[model samples]
Target: MKSNVYMFLLGTMCLLLLSCGEEKLPKPRAMLRLNYPAPVYEDLDMDCSYTVKKNKMVQIKNAKYTRPCWYNMYYPDLKATVYLSHYEIKNNLDSLLRDAQNLTMEHHIKADGIKNKEHINEEEKVYGTLYIVSGNAASPYQFYVTDSIKHFVSGSVYFDARPNYDSILPAANYLQNDLMHFMETIQWKN
Candidate 1:
C-alpha cells in the first residue's frame, strides 16, 4: 500500500513538472485574417442616367424606385448591401450635400470614429467624399460623388447582422473597397 501511494504521488509530480514545459497563459486578443480573390469589375450601364464600375462579386438588384436611379449592390457571400442613389442636380446641391452628410453622421452614436476622405477624379468629373465609420455602427462606409452641377450619386454600405466590428470588419472592408472603386469609376451620362 505504501509503494502504491508513492508511485501515484510520483506520477502526479512528473505530470506537474512536464506541464510547465509551455507556460500556460490567457490567450491574447486576435483578429481573423480574411483573404479575397483579385476583384473583377464590369461596366454597370442602364437607363439610370449614370455609369459606374461594379465588382463582379456583387449582384446588382433594382431596388424599389425611391426615385429612379436607386440600386442595391448585394453581396450574397458576405451578406452585405451597398445602397446607391443617384440624383440629377437641379439646384438642390446644398440639400443633397447636406442629406448625404447627415446620413453618414447618423451612425455617430455607435461609431468610435468617423473619417472623411475627399475623392476627386477631374477627368471622370466625379467628385465626392468617403466616410469611414469605425466601430459598431450599422453603416461602416458612405460616400457621394457628383459633377457638382448635374449629377449626384451617393452610397452607404450595411451588413445584415448585429454591429459587431470583429465579425463584420472583413466584410465591411471588402464592400468599402468596392464602393471606392465604384466612385472612382463613376461617369455621368445624359
Candidate 2:
C-alpha cells in the first residue's frame, strides 16, 4: 500500500511540474514601428534636385521617383523606392568615400548586439565603393560613394518585424548599388 501511494505522489508532482513549464514560455511582443527619413520628392515632373550639405560632398542634381510597392516581402506594408540624388564634380569624392567607410563602420559596431553582416566592394566604378548588409528579419541597407560625381548616397529597406539578428548582408548591397546608380545619373546644374 505505501509503495503504491509513493508512486501516485511522484506522478502527480511530475504532472504539476510539466504544467508549470508550459506557463513559463514567453509570449510574442507586438511589432515595432520603423522610422526613416520622410522622402522629399517635390520635383516629380523634372528630376528632383538635392542641395549640397556644408560638406559639398554631393548635391542633388535630379532624381526619378517611383512609388514604393507592397510586393517586397521582406518589408511588408512599408513603402520604398530608388532615389537618384545627383552631384557635380569629383573634387571631394575621395572624402565622401572615406566618410561612407566611417559611417558604415560605426553602424556595424552599433548593430553588433543585433544582426550585423556587411561587405565592401570596390572597382565596380572608376572610383567608388558599395557596402551591403543583409539578414533574416531585417531588410538590407546600402551606401555608395563615388569619385566621378563627388557624391555619397545612402539608402535602406526596413520591415515592421524585428530584423533577424543575422543575415544583414543582402539589404546592405542593394542600397549601396542603387545609390551608386543615382550618382552615375547626376548632371551638374551649373
Candidate 3:
C-alpha cells in the first residue's frame, strides 16, 4: 500500500538524520561560571567609636548620618551593600540585643535556617553573635558585635538584585569574609 511505503521512507529518513547527528537535542541545565579574585584588605580608620580593617574592593559610604558610627560598605561591582548600625549601650543593653535578635529573626519567613555563632575576645572585651541566614531573603547575613558594656554594632548585607540565592551567593560570600574581617579588627575606643 502507499501508506506502508510512506511509513518506510519516513523511518529511513529519521534513521539517516539521527545517524548523521544532525538532530540537536536540548542540553541539560548548567550553572554559570563566575570567578572572582581573592580580596586585598586595607585598614579603614574612622573618627567613630570603633575602627575596622575593610576589604579594598569595598568602599565606604556615609549613607546613615542620622546615627553616630553608622555607615555602609558599598560593593559597586557586586551591586550590594553591607549596612552598619552602631549603638551606644546607654542603659539599654538588653533592649539592643533583643532588637538585634528580632531583626535577624524577621528573615526566618524566607530563610531556610538561621545559624548563630558567638565570638569573644576577652582581652579586648569584644563579644558578639554572628548570624548566617541561609535562604533567598533580603539579607543573607546579619551580625551584632558588642563589648557588652558600651559598644554595640550590627550589620546586614543586602543585594540590590531580586531574592535569588543562586545569583547572589557569590557576592554574599565575598562580603561575608569582609564582614568577619571588619568584626575581628573592631577596636572599641570606649
Ranking by lDDT: 1, 3, 2
What tens-digit string does per-residue lDDT give for candidate 2 at 1-190? 9999999999999998877754565878765544433323222223322322111122233233442211121222233333333344458766655665665555554354333233333443334344444334243454443335433444444544455634334333433443444434433232
The lDDT per prediction is: 0.87, 0.41, 0.85
Candidate 3 backbone collisions, by pair: none
Q: 38-153 in candidate 3: lDDT tens per residue?
A: 88878778878887788887878986577767889898888899899888889999999999999999999999999987878898888888898888878988899999888899
Off by over 4 Å in 2: 1-86, 110-127, 134-139, 145-152, 160-162, 166-190
TM-score of 1: 0.85
Q: Number of clashes in model 1? A: 0
| Candidate 1 per-residue C-alpha lDDT over 56-148 given as tens digits, one digit per residue, 9 for 90 to 100 | 888889887857888898988888888888888899999999999999999999999999989898887789999999999998999999999
Clashing pairs in 1: none
Measured with C-alpha atoms, the lDDT of residue 138 in candidate 3 is 84
Question: For model 2, what is the error of residue 184's alpha carbon versus the real structure, in angstroms, after optimal superposition?
Answer: 9.5
Write down the lDDT that model 1 would get: 0.87
**Sequence-dependent TM-score of model 2:** 0.36
